[model samples]
Target: MDNRDAVSAFLRSRRERITPEQAGLPVYGQRRVPGLRRGEVAALAGVSVEYYTRLERGNLKGVSDSVLDALAQALRLDDTERMYLYDLARAAGPAPRARARQREVRPAVRPSVARIVEGMPELPAFVMNNRLDTLAANSLGRSLYSQMYADSTCGANVARFAFLEPAARRFYADWERMARFAVGALRIEAGKNPYDRELSNLIGELSTRSDDFRVMWGSHDVHVFRESTKRLNHPLVGVLELDQETLSLPDETGLSVVVYSAPPGTAAEDSLKLLASWSATTGQDQHTESASEPSDRHL
Candidate 1:
């Protein structure tokens, strides 16, 4: 969780996976290792071997933004990977100038947003934070995630459920895919707000409790949950395949609303209709998830 450990692990993992040939460098007959060496990456990034070695050794304090970008490029980082690199560097480098606090999520639940969800009664929709905390859900959204409300604790966190609850694994047919998305989203948040006390504690608890979470976290496979396909199991309506659209609130920080829909005439579409019906009959409920899952798994 420290910058030093995060930097060392992230770079080492990325470097170990990329081959010299893939970077278009000559593999030559005598090469033994699979990926580019430290010196090789340093050369590609236009930095001295000694400096790059220092960087890899957890000495990222005072590293320049340009240098970080160079390393990201040399490593052939994707959007998520590149962002994570910068986040780590930012965390380790010089103290940031104090500025206004950016919550990044609209705290107010807009009436218009609720109206929109109400209009699409058949679709399952809800709002969540960068930290994956559920803020609001429409009627159908409540039914779609009925299991989440099976408990008395009016509030529950999804990440806690995904890793700690066995039912979550069973609930999500595509458990592994969902889990990866969860990890990726969490990674992005970690980079965005490294010092968030709750987040830090959550990560710490998970790291101690879930081996799988820790492994993926260490790998630093940062990702954004902009859009995704999901498979959900419903008690009354069976299973559904829904296409989801996640819209970030431009007016707020860390808040985004997601809606899940199925094309007309599909069974999933019909299932969604059933969810709405169920919600109309049964009042909305609350969910309490197991928040003590371990977060340790080798990435």
Candidate 2:
């Protein structure tokens, strides 16, 4: 998708969410649209209606930071939305020379990184790149997301599992909300890395295959990942209310570690322990099977 269209759609979506009353504007006549009129937005931003109209029509190139800030204030955008606006603006600018390097998908994970995930035995932790590809995960992490790993065709893609796999509907308690959040996170990543071919392809595939994904993607929402509570209906351990913490790996750009945990003495914590036990048993069985296999040299 073109950056200009993204910019226009994002701004329009933000504008359409705020009513005149919410914007502290006096309601006058019958409103034709749901939110504040273009003129009202321009007035609130202290800009000309024509200029704001141009901006809303996908012309954000060369726009000053001050004007953007004013527009953001008028729209009452939060920090995440404001950052997304900046990302879209940067994307609309001249293409960078290093974009080709940035577009490379599936960067190799360092052994140390994998070890770090493995070290966190109690918590279900996994490392994923910006494209939401699961590069490395602990045993419990793998167990927690067993459904995603069940189908090799999907690989370790959280987005594909969420939208394409039927198990996702059963795994995530709030399936629709999780789906929207996943798409929004992907949208944010797309704005930051427009040249990412893999991300583009994934978006295309999801849009083509899932009608719900297509509709949510069309909304142009953006989300910044942070700590959140998730309710998972695990097939083995039943329900679990886990808290998620997403930590960025500074050395590895575009990669982050997501760890899931529950409070002490909670039923969720007991469920997590049960899950860990199951994972341990499963791992031992797999290890034994691999060890029992006859070596080619012996044969």
Candidate 3:
């Protein structure tokens, strides 16, 4: 995607969301526009109309940090939104550098990282990277996402599974909220690593294929997904309400482990214990049935 287009669209969208009343500008009468006029924003930002217009038109190269801050203040942008504005400016700047690209996930897993996941069998835990590739998962974690894991071709793509896959609609209890969180997380990831080729491709594909994804993506919203509460339906274990946390791996770039657990005495917690028991009994039954079955030669 062209950085200029991204910058322009993002700024325009943010600008359109605000009203003169919100910005403390008096709305004299019925206006032709939805948001503050160019001159009004410039005046509030302490910049000339021409300069502000240029910036909004995607000319952010060589812009001063102070001016960017002032513009951010004028727009009443939040911390994430302000950071996203700066990210776009830096990406569009003349002293250009390739943004971080997430191509293929590193093939080899860190042994210690795997061990940590294995140690937490009671907790559904897995590792993913900036590109939302699910790198590693414990047995319980795998079970928790059996709907996703059942498909061998899932290939660790969270966005695809979350939105494109039909099963996901039933799996996630709060589908709309999950979609928002997914798109917002992706936006944050893009700003953090503007040149991520894999991420860019995923975004492009989603934009082309899904109208819902396209609309949300165009909003330029960003959110850090460090923690969340999720409600999921598991075929074997039934529904579970889980709280999840994403923990960064200091030694690995763009890598984080996500773990989910339910509080004790909750229905979800009980369901997990029952699932464990059922899995053990199912394993034993399978083994016993295998013993009774005839071999190929006998057949």
Best by lDDT: 2
The digit string of per-residue lDDT tens for model 2 on 43-123 reads 999999999999999888888899989999999999988888888777777765477465673566677777788888889
TM-score of each: 0.84, 0.89, 0.86
Ranking by TM-score: 2, 3, 1
lDDT of 1: 0.72
User: Candidate 1 on 28-145: residue-level lDDT in tens?
Assistant: 6886775789999999999999999999887788888899889988999998888888777777654332211333223655677656655666677776777776666666776777
List per-prediction Cα lDDT, in the order shown: 0.72, 0.80, 0.73
Q: Residue by residue across 238-260, what tens digits does model 3's lDDT show?
A: 78998888888888877788899
Clashes of 3: 2
Off by over 4 Å in 3: 94-108, 153-155, 278-299
Report the candidate with higher lDDT, 1 versus 2.
Answer: 2
Q: Which prediction has more favorable TM-score, 2 or 3?
A: 2
Off by over 4 Å in 2: 153-155, 284-299
* Residue 276 local lDDT, model 2: 88
Spell out the clash pairs found in candidate 3: 99-195, 101-196
